[model samples]
Target: MAALIMVDEPSVQGGRRVSVFRRGREEHLGTAFSDHDVIVFLQAAGLSDPEEVLDDPRWVEWSGGRDWKRPPMR
Candidate 1:
């Protein structure tokens, strides 16, 4: 079976960022500051066609929805 990736909700504590994790793993793969960063992270993790990976539910599970745009500062 293909590896499952999880994109967590965006956090604004120290600027807007999203955490990427492998399902069932304790440690995260990395934090992404932008949508591009997420693609890069996935590429580094050996996933080809990052765009398709992001869209496919079988590969990625987006928490709190997939909002690539960074939220406005408070």
Candidate 2:
């Protein structure tokens, strides 16, 4: 099973986003891309910061929001 991801549009905002997933294909990666590493690019390229986002009190304060849980194992 793939680890739960914490970011969205991992590659759409970044260029050439890639990852070596432990899980195979056909799993809901929690976003449109394969991994959350794209956030690194977005943060580095001045688009977005994953750390800053995680620091947001709204997201952290909220408890009922969508969580990034591992996909159901086969």
Candidate 3:
């Protein structure tokens, strides 16, 4: 799975935007790209500290499970 998360896009007035995908292909969540939604999604996904995700590229992949639980991506 792949996820592209954007926080405060455009400007501070903007919200978060997330795109979910599977096998390098988008899953098509069927909605406009909303902003500021990443906080909720991350919490529900059992993850905190959005900075960690932003700081690392590996967090971009969803290996059918929690990527954080795995070793650091290289």
TM-scores of the candidates in the order shown: 0.68, 0.29, 0.32
Q: Rank the candidates by lDDT, best first.
A: 1, 3, 2
Q: Candidate 3 clashing pairs?
A: 15-35, 15-36, 16-35, 16-36
Candidate 2 residue-wise lDDT, 1-74, digit = tens? 23323243223333222222224542222222222544553344343445554435442222223233344445
Better of 1 and 2 by TM-score: 1
Poorest stretch of ten by lDDT in candidate 1: 13-22
lDDT, candidate 1, 1-74, per-residue tens: 54377777777642233334555564456777666787887788777889877778777777767766566667
| lDDT of candidate 3 over 1-74, digit per residue (tens) | 33454222222222223544445664433222232344456555456775467445555533232222222345
lDDT of each: 0.67, 0.34, 0.40
RMSD of each: 3.5, 13.3, 12.5
> What's the lDDT of the predicted structure labeled candidate 1?
0.67
| Candidate 1 clashes between residue pairs 3 or more apart in a chain or in different chains | none
Could you say which candidate leads in TM-score?
1
The list of candidate 1 runs beyond 4 A from truth reads 1-3, 14-27, 69-74
Off by over 4 Å in 2: 1-38, 57-66
